[model samples]
Target: MKTAASSVISDNDNTPAQSIPRSPRLLETLLANLDGVVYRCRDDAQWTVEFVSEGCLQLTGYLPEELLLNQRISFLELIHPDDRQMVRAHVDDCVRLRRRFDVEYRIVHVEGAIRWVWGRGVGIYNADGEVEALEGFMQDVTERKEAAQALQEAERRYRSIFENAIEGVFQTTPDGTYIAVNPALARIYGYRSPEDLIVSLRDIRHQLYVEPERRSEFMRLMEEHGSVSNFESRVYRRDGDIIWISENARAVYGDAGTLVFYEGTVEAITERKLYEAEMRHQATHDALTGLPNRNMLHDHLQRAIQSARQKGGLTAVAFVDLDQFKYINDSLGHQVGDELLKTVAQRLMSCVRDSDMVARQGGDEFVLVLQNQTEGDVGIAEVMQRILAAVSRPWQAGDREFHITSSIGVSRYPTDGKDVETLLKNADSAMYKAKEQGRNNFQFFAPWMDTQVSNRLEMLISLRRALDQQEFKLFYQPKLSLKDGRIIGAEALIRWESPEQGMVAPDRFIPFAEEAGLIVPIGEWVLRTACRQNKAWQDAGLPPIPVAVNLSPRQMNQALPEFVANVLADSGLSASWLELEITENVVMKDAEKTVATLNTLKRLGLQISVDDFGTGYSSLSYLRRFPVDALKIDKSFVRDIARDADSAAIVKAVISLAHILNLRVIAEGVEDEEQHAFLRENGCDEVQGYYFGKPMTVDDFTDRLRKEAVQAAP
Candidate 1:
């Protein structure tokens, strides 16, 4: 056994020798095949080498012949200057202990490049106690040493980053067991320390992450790409509060490159996720009521329509308009109006299902989108009735108990119209019908409602043309004094004789004109024409009964007093010869604005009268505040004064109220002797009715004036 081992060592370290030893011959053969040099050298400052192999030439870039047997360079000259002392010290220390010496150091090669080498030597002691030689092995170990140094540097750099990184860094085993974690990781995991996290969070899936699938997904991504990027998932903190995190990770491999564990970093993104969700919600919701707005309504309705059409079911779009909203807004201020709208919106929303949508179209208008229904229009009607009842219930605002009402109009998808705009228009038209039936009502569209819609469209078209073609004319109705039976004034009334539809009455289209915002222009034209015609009457030797022109509420507000002043100036008529007849409802539309406008009108020296008095709800105390000259009893009272005691009482009350207000009185709608006699007995200052004379054409009116003037000759 010793022979075999000696033979193996000799073959691995063959060297030149004078003795004919079989081991040496085998060693020579092995040394010739080796990648290291075997040498025998004297222990001295410049150790003289007795023999060297060809491997030395490859290691130090020098020939073996140049360093052999003290003939030329020695072994000590091969070492780098900076590492030579340390190498020498280690070698001496090993030699003094009479043991094997081993040293690794950098060497300066013959070519002037640096090389690292590992030297091992066993000192051979002579019997006289002097060092004979150092027989050892030397090889090129520069590559291994450099690789070890580079690995150490990389470990240090990674440790520094792991300790200081903002995102958490961690390492876990393949079974989702936490192996190691940095301080950042510990804090992210809501642990007191890194050790605490590694100990407590043994099972990452169960202990750390809220969803176990996230860990599985993490494993999946690692397997697919050997890494992960922005792997977001929800995790529970130590306190059990969930938070969102994003991970950049990699699968760590072992010695054989089999995946052993997952190494990753995670960053919290809870705030960013919350902000994105809020942004999405705000984009779809109304800012005022925090409900779905028109934009969301369109999407919801479209989807519902498609579903209903496919299933042969019902979907409705009901347009809800708050009744008398304008009056409430004008009287109570917009703050109160806004509160009322919010209350109504909440109540209306409560009456519908979560699947349905309640959207505010803007200001007192809402559009409800109803979803699938098997009962078709019946279901829509029931829903609308429920919503109307809910919204109209009494609400307390501040200290006042206020009662509100709504007009609801429903149009079904595929039944009323296929598209949103058409359905909305149809619903709006039906909503007007709801208003026409005196509000607090719901109207489902019928075929006759289409006729009213067409009429309105025709009226709007005629109006646009009326301004250009001069088809609209002013007719004067004489207001005669009751005592003298002479023309005290005349009322200027609008008469439309369209080329298509001739002879439109004031009652038939005036309300439509007011709604369309065409009344301002039409009313201004009436004022200017009446002022000019009145001056013309004076020019033609007719009595100038200050021409009275009725002003709609819209006209009174939309046209400034300056516009009226300009019209009066342009017509070259005296301001005192013009009277503006406004209804009590119109004057009380906005008390402050109305008073300001009336004061401006009064400054122009024009007489102002409240028309259709005792009909609208105006406080008698407030009536004294108006800048007006007279009050006209509404025709409703006169229509039934002879039959209804209530009508007579209303008429008498209006006259007394006008007198208390220090305003003159005029009675309208006096067609018979009873109404006239009743109004006269009530001390009404004047009367303008068919009992006096009916409204007539300009030529006939002039003829009557001639006849009256002939009778008036004294």
Candidate 2:
């Protein structure tokens, strides 16, 4: 085939005399082996083919002689129908100009195949410069054209993915310069466009990453492992805002094993990071004040001890307790109590260095860790002084200004037994000592401090026995109707009658019982006893009046309403004859749960009263939701109502508020006629205080009821 093409080339150089048909073997051999057709045809409408090479059989599935001079088919018919007019116009323009023409168009083969072909040719002219014939070479370039089109379509698809993907995609050099970035990348970084991002962000180390070391870490990972996944970092956006981002990236290498760039995808994980942080904070810190809680405090204390041991320096664990916090909490409300805690937390933080740790060890108790104290007790004393000053500062809740102080107990490391538990115990013991020695002062642990703990243990044992021995007795205080001056109801107060001791007041044992978790059982006993006694009185032909029993905070659980219903049923007493008194603090603790419980109790037809109404931080919004029937003004207000204008105002306001809510108002501790007249004038429905009668034993109360019944008999 090479020799034939060489001979054809030699023949084309021959003059006319030498070209006189020397068998035409070389030209015929070359044409027969060629892959494309060589043709000449008239430049007319039919595109008459005058001659065609042997390669026409392969190119168009037709023998060379079959298409010669319009013998069988016109060459124009082989061109695609849609492209025929275009082909004709192109050739005509080229012919008129007498220049070579090149075009690509589809053609049909005899076997019903459509193939793309490239045609390059020039015009042969006759006299008067008119076009006579056209000469051209056509090649079947279908495979090449299809390959080129496939490449273009693949590029278009990749471009679409780069432009429209939700995750940001980027390509950058090893030295922290961006090479290419997609639209998603620009949007993720708060940029207007990809071009704008590329132009503005030049240094990824300083300009993009909030911490420049993150970029170095990224490059180090790529260099060592060739890829990185889930590499999270805090970065600065185009708007100069910080956000969290996670990257999945790999090194893109050149053919010579050199790193061309780093290609990666980025996800903005700011919200995810924030949510995780909140979860972690909630786990380790107090939700109310955002201070480290007991769980975190233990860990921090251990770490501080370890640091102190290694440095051979002293560390102080100071247990801080707010003085009279419980009184303030019970008298004012838990809302005020929480505010006091938060205020104390801020002051405690202000007293310590940045290296110190302040942690909340449950309610009203905080623990501080003062580490690296080489100056011994003097340094701790200075901090303690500062703490005392800060905590003693005046603060306000509502319209009233309050002065608060803290009692701190300090235990030095190595001196406090060198462990987290021991240090905390000693500190706590010393805190109690400080409280005993007149609060608002600091105390160091003494070896004899174990007495306080032993006393607590003894009280727990006695309390548990007191419950088993039925040493608890109920005393009833009569509630008098202010309008008619007659006893209408009575409050059942629990009294502990110990065998080894005289009568124990509620305040002496109730707090210990509550802390020891014996309150729930004790409360149940009180309820049962009160119900049975009231029923006995009614059975004995005495005038029946509603009997009120206080519900402790711990006893106000999901089981209380059902328990009360069962007690009423057991005693055979009408629900209308029973009243359950719940404290304001108890009701406000979990408002939704309290509402549900109160509604259930209400369904049982028992009278409910908010005991100590003005004392607690009860919101009127939640107050309206409670299913209580009355509000009991606390004895504290009535004890000095006539002497104190504030007390008088509070009593009147409560009476008005209760009436507005359609609830009955009862005043307690009305000791004189002046207080009674003040309450009666303000429309107080009932008064329960020494003015009417003191709390009496069951026998005394039964006798008194009988006397009243006899006197009422007309």
Best by TM-score: 2
Error of 2 at 635 (Å): 33
lDDT of 2 by residue, 1-714 (tens): 235545565667665544444446757777767778888998888889988888788888888777887677889998999999999999989888878999999998899999999999999887888888898898899999999999999999999999999999999988888989999999999999999999999999999999999998988898899999999999998878999999999998999999899999999999878745654565467655768877678888898888877878888999999988898999998557877998899889988889989998877999999998878898889889899889999999899998888898999889876899889889989998898889899998877888667878998899999999888889999999988888899999999888887799998889888878999999999999999999999999999999999999998888988899899999999999999999877987899999999999999998999997765557677889999999999876786577667567667777877999999999987888888888998899999988889999999998899898999999
What lDDT is reached at residue 628 by model 1? 92
Q: After superposition, how far is residue 249 of candidate 2 from its true place, in Å?
A: 4.4
Per-residue CA lDDT of candidate 1, range 1-714, in tens? 346646555567755433336665667788877888899888887888888887888888889989986556678888888987998888888888998998888888888999988889898898987788889998889899889989999999988998888889888888888887889878887899999987787778878778898888888878889999988889999889999999998888889988888888889998767644544454455444667766667777878877877887777888999988888889997557867888888998898888888988766899988877667777777888888789878888788888889998888777889988778888888888898889988998765787566778987887878877898877768888877778888887789998777898877778688779888888878888888888887888976678898887887663568888998889888999999999866876688888888999899999999887755445554677889999888775687787766557556766776797788999887888987778777888888888788877778778888788888888
**Stretches of candidate 2 above 4 Å error?**
1-33, 38-41, 48-74, 108-114, 122-132, 163-179, 182-219, 227-249, 259-284, 323-333, 372-395, 400-408, 432-442, 451-714
Which 10-residue window of candidate 1 scores lowest in summed lDDT?
Answer: 279-288
- Clashes, model 2: 1
Q: In model 2, state the lDDT of residue 42.
A: 88
- TM-score against truth, every candidate: 0.50, 0.54
